[model samples]
Target chain A: MEILSLNQISPDQVVLLQWGVVRITATLLYTWVVMAILILVAILVGRKATADTAISRWQNLLEVVVSSIREQIREISQDEPDHYTAFIGTLFLFIGLSNLLLIVPGYVAPTSSLTTTAALAVCVFFAVPIYGISKNGLAYFKEYFQPTFIFFPFHVMGEFTRTLALMIRLFGNIMSHDKVIAILLAVTPLFFPIVMHALGLLIGMVQAYIFSILAMVYIASVTQAHESHGRGP
Target chain B: MHIDWFVFAAQIINFLILVALLKYFLYDRIVKAMDARQAGIASRMEEAERLRQEAGRHLQEMEEKKRQLDARVQEILNQAVRDAGAEKERLLALANEEAQESRRRWKETLAREREAFYDRLRLTSGEIIFSTIRRILGDMADAALEEHVVDTFVGRIRGMDEQAQELLRRSLDDSRSEVTLVSAFELRPDQQEKILSALGPFLSHDVTLRCEVRPELISGIELVSQGYRLAWSVQRHLETLEEAFKEALREELPEVNLENAGGEDAPAQEGSRQPHQSG
Candidate 1:
């Protein structure tokens, strides 16, 4: 457990699967753990969920969470929230659970590992085009050539660069927060490290929310592009 | 920076798996529940609105019924009042009619009673007057009254109106040539001679004289020939006196009344005989 190794930017992972040169890592294991927790809770809460006026405590909590995400999706999408709920909701949950696991001892946050963050960012990168294409068809590509054909390169580069930013932004924040806590604890061995870890928790949730919102914005921009041209949907 | 392509690929695969798993477990179920609850709330609100509209309609119907009931009640009350007023008027008219009939009946009864009382008084007065006069005349009668009556008849004949003289003459013609003289008492021969001499001028020729006494003629004399009745008797005088008294009684008792007093006029002996007839 090389917690304070500045030279190796990615955390040492406990591998889960390996085939010839390909490897599955511990970050994947932790992400799987988060996935299991989310899945199990969803199952129990889903059973508790009722269409009646009165509801159970679990159903009430889940309703609050689901509605809040629905409202956020509606604001960004400016369209129906039904189709986008799953994609945006899964992104927030995965990232939020990864940060939430920080309170457990010896738990390495999957978000704090570059490969894990890059993988999540890569999913968002692919999801934007998928959602945009699904909403507006091939016409969604017109937004890239907007203003002039001269803006085409900048628009194309902007997509990959934003994807890179999404990856680096999450990875840098979680990794640096973890490194600072590790350094504080290695030096002071106590209180300052605990405070910084708590701060890191807040930063982790903020980053997850930012990632989800950005993905939603990207999908909405493409879907709503024709509205600016006075074409009623 | 050390980059491992295999780990990166594995991490990306892991993330895609997480996205898929979470989407299936959490996002799908929760969103479906949320959509169902929204539909339920909308259904509940619509039901509440329907119930409220029904309640309003029911309230309006009730109000209309109440208004009709109130109007019916008022009509009944008005009819009752009208009937009562008409009944009161009919009853009052009946009472007034009954009162008038009773009053008229009472007046009739009173009038009949007054007439009966007057009839009894007249009968009693007649009897008393007749008896009283009979006694007075009986006491006064003798030959003097007869002589005076004979003189009055002679004087009446001398100054008679032509129509009366003719009437008396015609009556005398129709009879047998005889005259009858009645007296209350037996008369002397000389007295009869004087009466006969006094009446001789009115006779057409010689008239045979017949003398008779009637006790009812309490005083004076009466001469009868055919349909001519020349009388100056106490019975006839008494009748005249009773009539005078009845006239006086009628004047005094105007309200009580003695309506029928039979007073036939006497045949007067001209100017001299007028006093006796007037009495």
Candidate 2:
């Protein structure tokens, strides 16, 4: 078994299976592993979950994680968490889990891949409009042409740039953390790599929070446009 | 730095699938359970509040009942006290009235006893004095005294007032029976004739003269004609003296006749002192 090296910029470059045009990369394999772990834990803990005050430790932990995510969503959006809890919670869970798993030997973090980060950013980009339209109907698109027609292209460009920034930010931070930790491991191969790996964990969790919060902000700007517009220039 | 489009699309699909799975298995169930638990807690709190209020009301009702019972007890006690006081007063009044009646009866008995003592004293003293005087007069009486008594009687008949003479005359005229002369001593025939001759001027018609001797006269002489009588007797003089002594005794000891002083006994006592006459 070959360990994933710092030289590989993304897990996507490592192909696990190959066909004519269907190449199953390490990114997809690791993503599937993370997904399976999340699903399996959810099923196991959720099945035994009770409304009673006495709950299993696993159920308690899961509730804490889910509720914390809901709270964060509520705070960022300044709205009820129910509408955004699923998408936002999944993003944080998947990214946070993937980043946390970086401590394992030979484990390829899916979020370290440009493809996964881009995919998550794209979801956020599309979800913002979907949530906005659900909340404000077709009027949500009118925000793009606000103030005058002269600022229309700029608003459109700002949307694409923000989406691109969301992708690049998560990808760059996680990839850089992995690279730095791998480089330090190679250079010192001792106590220093442990510290960097610990730092990497912190950076990874912070990135997950940042990514989810940014997505929420973007979605809230569209969904709560009237409130923002009412606040004035 | 190149993005794998297939991997990107697959990752997006994987995330969307995860979102759906988590939403179904985790978020919905947890939120529902929390809501159900909150609702149960709220209802339990409501029930507790209701029970507390009912208990408060029951406590208040009990206190009110206790207050009413206390008031009733006080009222009954007061009424009993009032009744006891009334009974005490009534008993006291009865006792007072009985004591007054007893005192009145005692005074009446004392007065009755005193009146009886005085009557006995008056009767005994009058009997003693009159019996003594009669004994003295009887011891002194003789034929010569009888002769003087007949002469005095004849003189009294001759010295009678006109009214007395007229009353004697009317009595003699109305008499169908004998006119009698009686003496304590034997009267001589001449002396008797002298007494009858002195009474002759008062006679309206010829009436029979009967001579009788009575020792109870005690050295005195008497003449009787139906409803009219003339007497000269030491017994009469003694009776007048007894009456005078009784008047003096009544003046000296007012209490002796205090019981009958102004009553029916007074007039009857006064009538007893009148001269002996029959209509």
TM-score for candidate 2, please give it.
Answer: 0.59
Question: Of the true contacts between chains A and B, what fraction does model 1 have?
Answer: 0.64
Tell me the tens digit of each residue's lDDT in model 1 across B1-279.
445666678777766676676567666767677778789888888998999999999999999999999999999999999999999999999999999999999999998788767756675767676787688878887668767766665566656778666766666676677888887878778877887776666667777788898887787677677757666676777766766766776676665534443323322334332234221
Structural similarity to truth (TM-score) of each candidate: 0.59, 0.59
Candidate 2: docking tier: medium
lDDT of 2 at B211: 83
Model 2, A44-128: lDDT tens digits are 8878878777888888888888788888888878899999988888888899999999998888789888999999999998998
* Window of ten residues with lowest summed lDDT in model 1 chain A: A3-12
Report the lDDT tens digits of candidate 1 across residue range A46-103.
7666677788888788778878988999998788788888778878878887887787
Worst 10 contiguous positions by lDDT, candidate 2 chain B: B263-272
> On a 0 to 100 scale, what is the lDDT of residue B218 in model 2?
77
Candidate 1: list runs displaced more than 4 Å: A1-10, A14-24, A146-149, A183-198, A226-233, B1-4, B88-279
User: Using lDDT as the measure, which candidate wins?
Assistant: 2
Query: In model 2, which residue pairs have backbone atoms overlapping below 3 Å?
Result: none
